[model samples]
Target chain A: MKFGILVNEGPYTHEASDTAYQFTKAALEKGHEIVRVFFYHDGVNNGTRLTTPPQDERNIVKRWGELADQHKLDMVVCVAAAQRRGIVDTDEAKRHGKDADNIAPGFHISGLGQLIDAGIKADRLVVFGD
Target chain B: MLHTVNKSPFERNTLESCLRHAKKGSAVLLIEDGVYGALKGTTVSGKVSEAMKSVTVYALQPDIEARGVQNRVLDGIKLVDYGGFVDLVTEHNATQSWL
Candidate 1:
């Protein structure tokens, strides 16, 4: 089955990110295909590489980066949400006249159309949020 | 359809509203604070039990454990781990999260 995951919350503050990560990992382990992972609302924070979690804590952003790398996942952060939360990719940074890009590896900033496309293409659309 | 609710029934009406919109044969998976609705003998359990007549119900085991409600879950609610969560999504045609 092909799945599309929608995450609507940020890391650490909520369990949504953790649960989404676990579900995504389990889906891949079970040999299911993940069509896309769409980050919206506060979830765009997960795409930023600037987070500095405590040494003892799990780096949720880095964990997502690793997972995306291993699976070659399509991790998309909503452009509107990212702009509101300051999660800028190289193009967005340049467009917005920002000094640098903060988007993490294996993630891209895209429009909400990607989310609509995921819904249309994937067999299931699973959402994780508050 | 698989309708997932992650809010506490006491704190939010997500579970109640989800039940209202769930079609016959749809499944409801309670996670996070939403697991509270699956607790046996709770006021909300009555409604959940009623909804069970037309829909299958599930609760995430880890979330129940985290909230210290493992022993209180109602009998009919199936418990699932993260892998089971994936299975549920696969079994269903689509998922709608009541966030």
Candidate 2:
């Protein structure tokens, strides 16, 4: 099965991101393909590499990046949401006159069309949100 | 359709609204704080118990155990893990997530 994952919350603040990550991992382990992982709303925060947490705690941002690298996952941070929340890639940063970019590895910025495309392509679109 | 609720019933009416709208034989899988709705002795327990008659109810096992309410889940509400979460999505033709 091909699955579309939609995440709508931040890393540490809500369990939504954790649950979504678990679900995505489980699906991949079961030999299902992830059509895409679409980050919208506060979920865009998951794509920022600037996050740092206590060493004792799980690093949610790095975890997603690792998962993407392992599975060759297509992880997209919504461009509109990322801009509003200050998550930027090199291109976006340069386009907006920002000096630096904070987007984490294994993620790219895109529009809502990618989300809609996932809905059309995947057999199931699972949403994890607050 | 498979309906997912992620907010505590005590904090929001999402579960109630989902139950009211879900068609007969639909599945309701509660996760995160929504696992609270699966408890046996809450104010909304009766409501959940009743909804089971029309729609099958499930609670994510990881979320339940994380909150340490595994023992108090209402009887007959199916418990599932993340793998089972994947199974539910494949079984259902569509899914709706209620915040």
* Shift of residue B46 alpha carbon in model 1, Å: 1.7
Instruction: Estimate the TM-score for candidate 1.
Output: 0.95
Query: Least lDDT summed over 10 consecutive residues: which range in candidate 2 chain B?
Result: B62-71
Candidate 1 local lDDT, B1-99, one digit each (tens): 899999989999999999999999999999987889889988898999999999999999999999888999998999999999999888887788998
lDDT of 2 by residue, A1-130 (tens): 9999999999999999999999999999999999999999999999989899999999999999999999999999999999999999999999999999999999999999999999999999988888
- Give candidate 1 misplaced runs (Cα > 4 Å): none
Interface RMSD for candidates 1 onward, in order: 0.9, 0.6
Pull out the clashing pairs in model 2. none
Best of the candidates, lDDT: 2
Interface quality of candidate 2 as DockQ: 0.94
TM-score of chain A of each: 0.98, 0.99
lDDT of residue A80 for candidate 2: 97
